[model samples]
Target: MQDADKNGNTNQTDGPEHSALLGRMLKGEKLALAKLVTSVENDAPFVPEIMEEIYPKTGRCYSFGVTGPPGAGKSTLVDKLIARLRAQDKMVGVIAVDPSSPFSGGAVLGDRIRMQRHALDEGVFIRSLGTRGTGGGLSRATGEVLRLFDAFGMDVVIIETVGVGQTELDIVDIADTTLVVLVPESGDTVQTMKAGLMEIADVFIVNKADREGADKMVSDLKGMVELNDCRETDWKVPVLLSQANQDQGVDEIYKELNNHREFLDTHTTEGERKAKIRRRHFLEILGHRFVKKVEMLAREDERFRDYLEEVQQDDANPYEITKTFFQDEEFARKIFGATQTKPS
Candidate 1:
């Protein structure tokens, strides 16, 4: 879709400029990669074009999502994971999704002080993204950014979420393997299950395993996993212990992650999983774009603006209004006519 500037003129970011940037990125230019990531995060008009150009270069990277409660040592775990991947001579890329400041729209904990040690490593590429008030503990552009990292030749791309919540489990929609981190005293095992963590976690890490109640927590998670049995695959979610700060038990956690990856590679269910994710991704983008197009039309059409005003004032119920609006042929003709030629 084409975007109009505040002056109501078409503003696009396509053409030779973005093509040159993509070409440089394909040649392993870090600066080009960084620039493309920034453009994606900002939702630049040229993103669709960039995604089209790089589509063939993706699928080589293994994406992992490290998510859990706040103060669960997720950053430390990610740092250690990056080290492990790098030790094996694999290039790693990290997308640290941090909470955004309501006032500034910037990440409150960008750079995550614990992970700064890898800042200078040539094989390690790290980018901190502000959630920007989006739900699901990640930015809307995170999936696109991962595509850029994959195209840039990262063997493994890790996304550290902004603390998992009931509705913040979108990481599972993107990651090939999801590691849900928790602490010893975080809460009861039932609470974890109620929080929707049980369904999304492929591997569980009880960080700060040296703390009190560590063993009990591990036992509880294993019990819960067993109770919800009747699985299609032989892989059982392993609740491993880890003192990430001390680097103890991390190796085993990495081993479990590898096992999970191997399971996905070998199982027939792999196709089903990918199909599910593809459906979710498609629906999400379609919904976002459809809403955006309607909003743009509402801004330009007098009758649509009046409809929006009525909805805002509660004079008409949104559900009925949406149904009626879509059924109106004139409404469809006008809106479709305006957006017929998509931005290149």
Candidate 2:
């Protein structure tokens, strides 16, 4: 019998099946790409093999991460951006991560509803994901899905994060250009600063610019940017106003996106920024895998269960128990494979 996770994905798939799926995905098959993303999101058994097969084919697509507070019209702005990209004959992929429904554990805001005009466009591929009770505005599998889209030959991929809190700031670590959208009524300059928006925003946009405070909000963002030397490059963060509902000021956003991409392409610090992002991604993957391994060990290892029981009974200090556990080479070998050596 095969074991299943909370997502109900069983751990018995063969490598050849994933290899075939990857082959189809690389050939620009939309259905295959969707299936690959679903497998990654479900944490299927063959995901590591699938990723390895597609890893070499990635890094061609340029990504934009759009984020802001809820009800700030981010979806509408992204819809406009997609139209602009489509005008240039670009093949675009969109990953819209929405907040999960507390009751159903599914995506609450379906971005397709806002972007229905592109439903029949063969050049565009759109996918929506639920937060799945994870933090950082994105699901844990978002990076994998982004990689799949890149490998599937998307010219541009836009990742729209759940616009809920400052925790959604993980988008900055992944996007080539981070576009932080805000509205006049979303919050004030101080609140933006408090939300850590100044540090992550490569371009600040005041959507729904027809509102009364839109110009003032743009002015405030500019002043804040000038006051805070947050950017690592010489590229100045541009703050623009946009009424997305009317499709006004969106062309400027497209122009600025290209300008920012050009700046990064030629900037001396581009390599350093990429290196930092790689380091962050490495640590995140390591931490997640480590925790999952520990959980699996705790569930199956009788010794680990006994240790947990001792800790729960207050018969032994957890710190000492953990210290002893690490010093046991046999236990380490059993849990992390025979290749793992115990620390001195």
Candidate 3:
């Protein structure tokens, strides 16, 4: 895929001239917002350079992630949250992750559609992200966008992921605060919660609270939460009720979020959260380096392609070829050239 120019949604331009994009983003230039995000989404070479220029002004925003099963009213809740945040005169950025359609390889992109009322509001910046075939429920660019919004001086950045299924727990690594939403009387709430979503919840919201069993569902969640890890004494995860469409009980939800952020700001939780963020960024960097090294080596090493052709032709057995693929001296040489680090 092609990237945009730094001034025009970030194209394939190559040079220090694009550095102004970062400065313009921090200055709250709207066009710069689109362009800078384009660079991050495409993993353009200019991303690191842009981020380095903007790094000092980063981390001003409180990052919150709202994640749950489909039909749990997460989008509605997020919409309500944005309303509350905006009433306080806060600048907000929302990144909504939509599932991609396998057949079409395009996201429905309905999240932004649901949020159309805010499209005209200058204080609210919202972007829709397709998972991009990641299977992991979030787009690869979600974290990078979070940093971008923070550097742009957003007061709060809320990220909503496609559903809180198993590996989609990747949200925990990226979000400073995560809210897990559920419906009342979903029968399998406990079973689904057992899939690790319960442990990740800083705030448990019973969205669609006007529904028949909302209260009962909230009670059941509280019961399960206590029995599961009641040992935290006062560390209970609050279960708030919200009728997202009607905007009922959203203020209290915001209160809970604020309280959780305050709790996390303490000395102990502060270090742990920062450490996790560091590790998350480190793994991302490592993944980028890994793929780049493999691609560069495969391009430069003739033996690498030769081995593949051999495997296809049955001139080499799987096990023997695997050994050769790794131990090939040229593999080491190309990798070292790409990564600037020696292979073990």
Kindly list the per-residue Cα lDDT of model 3 for residues 1-344, writing each as its tens digit. 34232122123456655777766776789788878776666566666666666766776689888887777888888888888888999999888765543311124444333676776799998876664423232445777788888888899999887676654567555777889888875658557557376667878888887779888888877887777662343556888888888888889999988987887786346667666767867777667655655654455446566766788874668898878767877666655544343322
- Model 3: CA > 4 A from native: 1-13, 101-113, 133-139, 230-234, 267-272, 299-301, 311-324, 338-344
- CA RMSD, predictions in order: 3.7, 4.0, 4.8
Residue-by-residue lDDT tens digits, candidate 2, 55-154: 7787778998898777788889888989989989999988876554321112443433377788579999888766443323254577888889998899
Can you rank all candidates by TM-score, best first?
2, 1, 3
Return whichever of 2 and 3 wins on lDDT. Answer: 2
Report the Cα lDDT for residue 117, model 3. 78
Question: Which residue pairs does candidate 1 place in steric collision?
Answer: none
Better of 2 and 3 by TM-score: 2
Clashing pairs in 3: 4-10, 4-11, 5-10, 5-11
lDDT leader:
1
The local distance difference test score of each candidate is 0.75, 0.74, 0.70
TM-score of each: 0.87, 0.87, 0.83
- The ten-residue window of minimal lDDT in model 1 covers 1-10
Worst 10 residues of 3 by lDDT: 1-10
What's model 3's overall lDDT? 0.70
